[model samples]
Target chain A: SQQGEEDPQALSIQEGENATMNCSYKTSINNLQWYRQNSGRGLVHLILIRSNEREKHSGRLRVTLDTSKKSSSLLITASRAADTASYFCARTSGTYKYIFGTGTRLKVLA
Target chain B: EPEVTQTPSHQVTQMGQEVILRCVPISNHLYFYWYRQILGQKVEFLVSFYNNEISEKSEIFDDQFSVERPDGSNFTLKIRSTKLEDSAMYFCASSEQALLGEKLFFGSGTQLSVL
Candidate 1:
């Protein structure tokens, strides 16, 4: 199974604090993407970082990829209650398929 | 701001029955996909379609499963026979291109319950 695994299956933080999640996969990948799912809702694409890139940022979200280690991390800075959701990391190898991780449940307390 | 749309937010069916889940992907998107997540489990890929044909499919997408574009705007997944283990949330997704790093827009999903 090439599915990625996310550490710290759950995390809790205050509104003003930063939250981070890590993902590790078993095989090489062409790119990695992070997505957020508000309970019972569709996944919203957050950001994507290619294997050649080290880091990318979008508004309050930051993503880092390390192809050498087959691992990636997502950081949400200045988290808010609205940021409370399940975050998943998906890796795409040479195919169109995206293998998703187990996901990290994040809770942002007011 | 186009988005994928799925019909029948929830469906309940008995084992051995056939059910077809429908989805309408973004208007301009060329790539379409179906994925499912069993309760308390990670999301798993089912199939990917492009050029009106299946480009890739996961092991879970066995003979019991089939996908069809059917028309210009609708994509459908038909389960030949539903089983107790078939209960899951099915999500439809689409992207303008099938490139390695392109982002996919997903639909809200349909929760299927097999009894």
Candidate 2:
């Protein structure tokens, strides 16, 4: 039941705009991972931010972790139509299992 | 980059019937896992496998479900007497090291429909 809550369940943005989503979990975690999934496709790894680290980046994706608040945020800069997908945050706490959030559904308009 | 592959992109089965979902994890990977997502729902972990044995399993993975590495390259999840609620998109993933530290490579996923 460590399921996290992702704000702005759905988002819409222009191609040149930036999209930001927030995730808040219920328990402490060692590392938090971000994943993206296109409709009907498997989830793809975007980035991973450890509890000790505050922020991590990969290409246009930026992930920030706030362990004290049990929350995290993902920012996509200059979004593209292809970047449209559901983004999820997953974390594990002293276990081999990962609990995924409901995810933020993003749509970028050209 | 090596990829995890799952067989039968989609599966349709009758309730009370048995269905086996097959997956071939990255050859060099040592850890395997199975996860499923019901339509419009969050992804749920079913089980994790390491060293040819189950490392961990969630409460959702009840006695009706079982996993096996029948051969060197294959990992399978068998659901006995499938129920309607079993319908979901099942994904298979693998990682070279412990998932807590390593990113996983996931297969395209197998859509299971229990009719």
Candidate 3:
């Protein structure tokens, strides 16, 4: 079974707008990491938030985690057409393996 | 920056034939992993290797699937007999550590097409 499920399976926004995607997991995790996959490409590590941390930022990317709710959200500010890709949240529990979410396909129209 | 690399950007094999996918992880990384993503499906974990042994594997990794770190720098996944359902994009990843919080670096992936 999948441990994490992403909401708004698909999203489309005009360039310069903000895009937010949410993910809910089924169990406690040591950390949660977000990744982006461009069409026909490999997964690209974006950012990671530890269980003890509530939020993290990198350039235009912001991620928030609420362990109490077992959920997390990824925000991309001032989106661009180059930001178009499928986003996935992976939850890491007490192991080296990461359980990935269903993913959210985001499209940034120019 | 160092990056994981996979060979044969695309592979085409017939059902019942054996196939071997190769990967070269970051030079100094100690943990290696394999993942597969079927078209229109989520990325699925296949197996994790550490200390020259398999640390963990998912249910999708069956007897027909095998992994080997043949030398110090190369990791390979071998499927004894390919099946049509096995066609997917196979990604190889590596991490500097085996801890839960370590980030992974993934290769571009090898698209497997089984006929």
The candidate that achieves the highest DockQ relative to the unseen native structure? 1
What CAPRI grade goes to candidate 1?
A: high
| Tens digits of lDDT, candidate 3, A1-110 | 65699989999999999999999998899999999999989899999999999999999999999999999999999999999999999988998898998899999999
Docking class of 3: high
Range of the 10 consecutive residues with the lowest summed lDDT in candidate 2 chain B: B97-106
- Give lDDT tens digits, candidate 1, residues A1-110: 79999977999999999999999999999889999998888888999998999999999999999888889999999999999999999989899998999999999999
Error of 2 at B93 (Å): 0.8
Count of clashes, each model = 0, 0, 0
Candidate 3 clashes between residue pairs 3 or more apart in a chain or in different chains: none
CA lDDT of each prediction against the hidden true structure: 0.94, 0.92, 0.94
TM of each candidate vs. truth: 0.98, 0.97, 0.98
Ranking by DockQ: 1, 3, 2
Model 1's chain B yields a TM-score of: 0.97
Candidate 1: tens digits of C-alpha lDDT, residues B1-115: 7889998899999999999999999998999999999884688999999999999999999999999999999999999999999999999999998677789999999999999
Interface DockQ of each model: 0.84, 0.73, 0.81
Residues B12-72 of candidate 2 have per-residue lDDT tens digits of 9999999999999999899999999999578989999999999999999999999999999
